[model samples]
Target chain A: MCLGIPGKIQSIRDDAGLVMGVIDFGGVQRDVCLQYVADEVQVGDYVIVHVGFAITRVDEDEARRTFEVLKEMSQLDELEWMAEAAEQGMRGLEKPA
Target chain B: MKYLSEYRDADIAKRLIGRIKTRATRCWTLMEVCGGQTHTIVRQGLDELLEGSVEMIHGPGCPVCVTPLEQIDKALLIAAKPNVIFTSFGDMLRVPGSDCDLQQVRARGGSVKVVYSPLDALALAQKHPDKEVVFFAVGFETTAPANAMAVFRARQLGVQNFSVLVSHVTVPPAITAILEAPDNRVQGFLAAGHVCAVMGYTEYEPIAAKYKVPIIVTGFEPVDILEGISLAVNQLEERRHEVENQYVRSVRRSGTEPARALVQQVFELANRQWRGIGEIPMSGLRLRDEFAAYDAERKFGVGGLKVTEPAACRAGDVLTGRIKPPQCAAFGTLCTPERPLGAPMVSTEGACSAYYNLAKYRTADPAGAAP
Candidate 1:
């Protein structure tokens, strides 16, 4: 299971002895069973849900840190690098044997 | 804690998108072979981010969408029995079978329940000892383990009232069928991560080599889909055809061994018919002879219930990626989700349902409505 999708917990309910909650992933909301990881969760906190179950809680600070790194990496233009590498290879081939 | 939150960070996703845009040289057509991935792609508007350079085609990964009309009819038949309590996933309730569905059966005073897991159905049988509980087990390899576990538990508990109407299908065979088709145009594949997690990526290696297509095991998320596409596009650009694992955090080369062994104990490969795709040899699963007592088809003696799909529904074309949802003549006018004329419009994982939910707004414009 891909423990993805950081959904904010809206509310909690006990349905037939099973801990359940309504989780919001942006605008879409779905009912998720929280019995699997109920001991580690709380309201207003974001948790990683997978296959209708909340698997683990995510630290917002950690998420923001990772996003910043990703943004920096995205700025690198691969096409320009590839073109430069190709031109260097062509010059080397022309000068040598 | 999981790799999930890091992978789905929007800032990172935009960065990945920018990286992909810079790397792209030519247009590429990639197909996410799992219906779950299709839903994830649409839900997050991943297509909008890719623009017109990347084409995402839907594949036949939806079990409910591809399950034959006749099998559903047979399930409806079993559910209508006076002492039977039919259990199924909620998505199967509205899938049209001949003239009726599980929802229709419930409306007609039949005992039918929507259960999240087959174990729940087994528990229902245990609690209601007087009634016969037959689970309408329908899914791909991802769901086979849980269903198989339920069967094993039923045998151990000697719960005679419990059984399963298994409609399980395998992934490799479907991929082979799609690649072999004369009209197939899938240049790359985003293999279902969960299916690979259960059955491993070994089966896909041969298919990828034979078809000369890149098969990347992908998770269902916005960034996961983009990363999968980027990987596939890289392979295509480099002319390297191989099976890659983008969801390596969960999937492995051998997959879940215990789960596979459990499935082997309860089920066997058999030639079965798909709704729109016709019959694919040895693609479906059937209960083993020893576990035949828990096979609802044998218990009920309802053979030869095979029925053809409706003439107006082009669900087969939709499943094969030969046509989009709007390409079907009956898509919007006659086959809304509330009044589905076919399985694709009904199941949540279905391509048609995804398009209906996300792309319907875009399709409102006359120029964009042409599929």
Candidate 2:
């Protein structure tokens, strides 16, 4: 229940008195309660859903930015580790003390 | 899968691991407060990769693990009654009460149903007007709004037959309690992101300043967790302690306002007893006076039920991070998932169950060899 999934809103409707919508998770569609997030979401927007309720609307720009930053930082660190490892290997090959 | 698969990219995870290892000057004890994060960390061996640099102590954030035994006993008492249909999330059925679980109650002719949502139970109540429908509402703040909505809608629709047995807890106080422990070594925390996505990180701000520990609101993925660790390590290395948002994509400084408003309307904070750990002041949520009629404990008259933890279970120690699950004498011998001696072993999100389920994936060295 703690693992909320980010799903794209496919359509919106009012079920009786509550605001509801069909959200597409990957390809599977599940009806979700959108009343909590009605003010912030629209068709094609992404929201983090838990137990059939949309808790918070996902920021498309923010999501892309976070991934970009992480990707860049990780790549930079990978190069640093490789350089450190190469220096260590060179030292290992030097004359034994 | 746009947001899902990218976070699990292996190259990025490896790099984050290397970054965290390089950043930390010495071993730092940090606790990930959500069971979901624990599962990711253990499954990906993130803790082992940063072994010497970080000690990831699993916190008591699993609602099923921390739900007081007395509440379980009350649920059992209410579930076994005639004409009352007990509805709960699938996981709660297997959790053992004093002598039997909800499944056993169903085995003995009780009407126990597993529901994915509280609205389903409300629907059942509407369908069978003659019977009463009770939902076992259990989770952190991530779940409270949905449960509160059910109650709010029930009252609005004039559905008198639906009620809930709420066992909801919050994260900030739990962090406070862990910090106040005299022997605590936790220098930082990876706050559960989903919880903050509901309650926001504002509550954690005071906690970070007062305790002087970096609390990074973290997501439930290998790369997210590794980045959260790296962020916390950087703060500690520089003698800085603050609440930072590692999960900026899903969470905001102020969480969803509509959800919070509904929860505030239907529930209020109360002193609650954790299943293994003792009572923490105002750590749990309960129905407000206006909505007291929707409380199952009040409606069914099972509120007086109580039970104590078994002497053999070392769950208290495990839940508080004093010892790992395997450190307990009864970890494997007396407390298997098939027959859990304590609450932590009962839920998949639980740290004990996480240890038991993912033990094979872990490296041979229990001490966690350096990366």
Candidate 3:
């Protein structure tokens, strides 16, 4: 089972000589390794995190195109609804910090 | 959720279905080569939507389901050993070995733990220097990079206690195996997107050309799968056999070179046995001789132990998309998730598990009725 989730890199740093980062999975944040994507990833760049490692950098244009295709198919309403909820969830998470 | 939420749009799924219906000239049987794709298809009722227009079959891509029975038995033996901390993903703990599962071993006083990553297992080795830490590495090319990095890190740190019981597999071989089958009904394939992300679609070109089947690298979301199906249908109608990328957002023609390099550096190709499906030459990744110390099989001496699958289970047929999960006499009766007769019933990504979890009503009465 190849279980990978998209996460945005919140911060990047070296942890004991290994490149690591704090990634935000929507609202939740966790530590991820940048060993595989060290050259391509930036602080704000999105990545596909699989098994604690950032396997590849998520292309901005491709991600936008996917959403745009869905939008063209008249499917943004549900995504809009979810985005609001996710934003709220992120706010809720931020309140603690 | 950023790259994920938009792919599950219901309206997009409907539109994709409409496109697939328009493109379909005749019935085309398409097989999705990933258990993750199967789960999404069942959960989202995509097959029901494309009913009569196209036939979607599940492939032998569930790593846990296809992992050889003897390998599980070896993992069990190692897990049961004293002063050994066994680590694996949550799914593998429930998968049955020859006689018992890792959960049973844990219940009987074994230190089997579920870890999110092989890196976590590496951390376990660092923290527990006195004990042996063995990560049951089970997955395909999608996971090889991560597992390879873990072993690489272990060697770099000189972590003598760390080792991995590898059962790594690749996707193209499995596709070839399916296409080579005598009764193979798959005209086109929806390749696993993540595997393509790591290994790219280059390898698929030859397979598609050789088999005269369209191989579309697809993602796991609802809309993504629908689009993938639509692409396959278009190919079938046009009589085209080529590798297309429906998940261009993540996949490329060449794939992630660094990850592939890491995997190639740490592992060498080997003949691997697929449970129910038997062995396929050069289908699996094994630790190189240079990294032999990090190999748990060699470290624990459990590579020779072997076992046979139960006679009643027809997971072989189910895995190859020859039949649905409920077609087996033991399905839902003798092979429920709680007491699984096969690995397909155990892993969450498994086709049998997906059918049972999302569409168990199909099992209530098996009168040969189509779902």
Candidate 4:
């Protein structure tokens, strides 16, 4: 039941009786239930989302720094780079001219 | 550092994907033996980023998906009891039994509550001392400790009204069953890291060696899944089948001793039936004879109830890795999240649910073609 993912808060929308927030992880964006932590969080913050609910917030600077280390650790081989380039090419083609 | 965000970095994920593509020798079939990993892989599109040479298959790690129809029927029986407050994780509410689901029971005026923790059910029992509170405990070893703890807590607190309808299963036995299956397609396994975090990796070493397949204990993150796949692919390419620990940060060779001790004290291994896979010996946990007072099925006389599964549901084949959700006759047609034909299509951690929510679009794609 643990469906937690680290996502950066893109924006928050306040509506009647509910708060909606858009969170982005990599390129996948999801509308997270911010009702749980609406009072404390802000745009540009990072949080752990579980089952569409934002369970807790994570430090944005610390999260970015950790990603940096993971990025370095991932560079342990070259086939990874080739796959990334190919994926990037696909993404480039998908973009509107 | 949260230590969680670092594990999910897309840049790091890309790096791992790059390494996997470079190191591939032949087409390797790696099965992530947990439905949590399946959801993560699909939701993040990690499989789309992997090298075409590596194929990631979903395993039967979903406890709800693998839970037999008889058990769900038993749960419904307990829920139907007057003044009985049947509490379960939200995922179990929609899982269809022989005839109906807990949701249907709720509609019929049964007191069915969805709790985030078993402790909450314990609290409900404390609050309503006059009524009986039965918690439908489900999941693999990952959830066994907590469920066992709830039982122990009830006993300690002298909450006579509280009992657990224990449906806890183990991972190793299921893995062994799958490997022994005649139509087994899994070449290697990404063992559920959370399960190993509780039960440890000691039991898996023998299975890996005996089956001659690599078992990597992996976390539920895109990068973790990629790393697990990379490790498994490397082992398969080199013909070295061994138990590897990619989730070393949380799981140890010897798991939490205190948790295991509590579980052992409360529950005993029993040959239980899986939804689609029939009976596998010593695959499930039941209340020990000593703890029979805390067993809801025995206390309520719901043990002997016989129930039949839906005729068209192919959840058993899907659970054993013999077929994917799309292969099921009812999948995407008669069965869906709203009207699941089986438990797999209903549970959040189910492979069918994972496919339904994340990969149903692929049904229209060319078969065996990469996105």
- Compared to the true structure, candidate 4 yields what TM-score? 0.77
Superior candidate under lDDT, 1 versus 4:
1
Q: List the residue pairs that clash in candidate 4.
A: A79-B18, A79-B22, A80-B18, A80-B19, B276-B316
CAPRI tier of model 3: acceptable
* Segments in model 2 whose C-alpha atoms lie over 4 Å from true places: A59-97, B1-8, B361-371
Q: Name the lDDT value of residue B10 in candidate 2.
A: 66
Per-residue lDDT of B346-370 in model 2, one digit per residue for the tens?
Answer: 8767888878766643455444422
Residue clash pairs of candidate 1? none
For model 3, what share of native contacts is present?
Answer: 0.44
Worst 10 residues of 3 chain B by lDDT: B1-10
For A1-97, candidate 3 gives per-residue lDDT tens digits of 4747666788899877789888775455666788788998899888877767888787665444544443333223222322332342311122212
Cα displacement (Å) at residue B90, model 3: 1.0
Q: Using lDDT, rank the candidates from best to worst.
A: 2, 3, 1, 4
Q: What TM-score would each prediction reach against the true structure?
A: 0.78, 0.88, 0.88, 0.77
Give each candidate's fraction of reference contacts reproduced. Answer: 0.01, 0.49, 0.44, 0.03
Model 2 lDDT, full chain set? 0.81
Please provide, for model 3 over B1-371, each residue's C-alpha lDDT reduced to its tens digit, 9 standing for 90 to 100.
Answer: 11223343656766878889887878889999888788777765678778889999999888889988898899999999999999887778888877899989999999887776688788878888999999989899988988999999999888999999999989999899888888888899999998988888899999999999999999877778988999888888888999999988788899999899999999999999998898988999999999999989889998787787877989988988878997999988888988998899987778888788655644554442232
lDDT of 4 by residue, B30-143 (tens): 788887787766555666677486777777788888877888889999999898999887778888877789989999999887764566577678888999999988888756
Residue B344, candidate 3: C-alpha displacement in angstroms: 1.3
lDDT of 1 by residue, B177-246 (tens): 9889998888999998768866889989988998999999997666778889999988988999999999
Worst lDDT window (10 residues) for model 4 chain B?
B1-10
Tens digits of per-residue lDDT, candidate 1, A1-97, equal 1223456777889865557787765444556656545776788877654434454456665334423332322211212222332343311011211
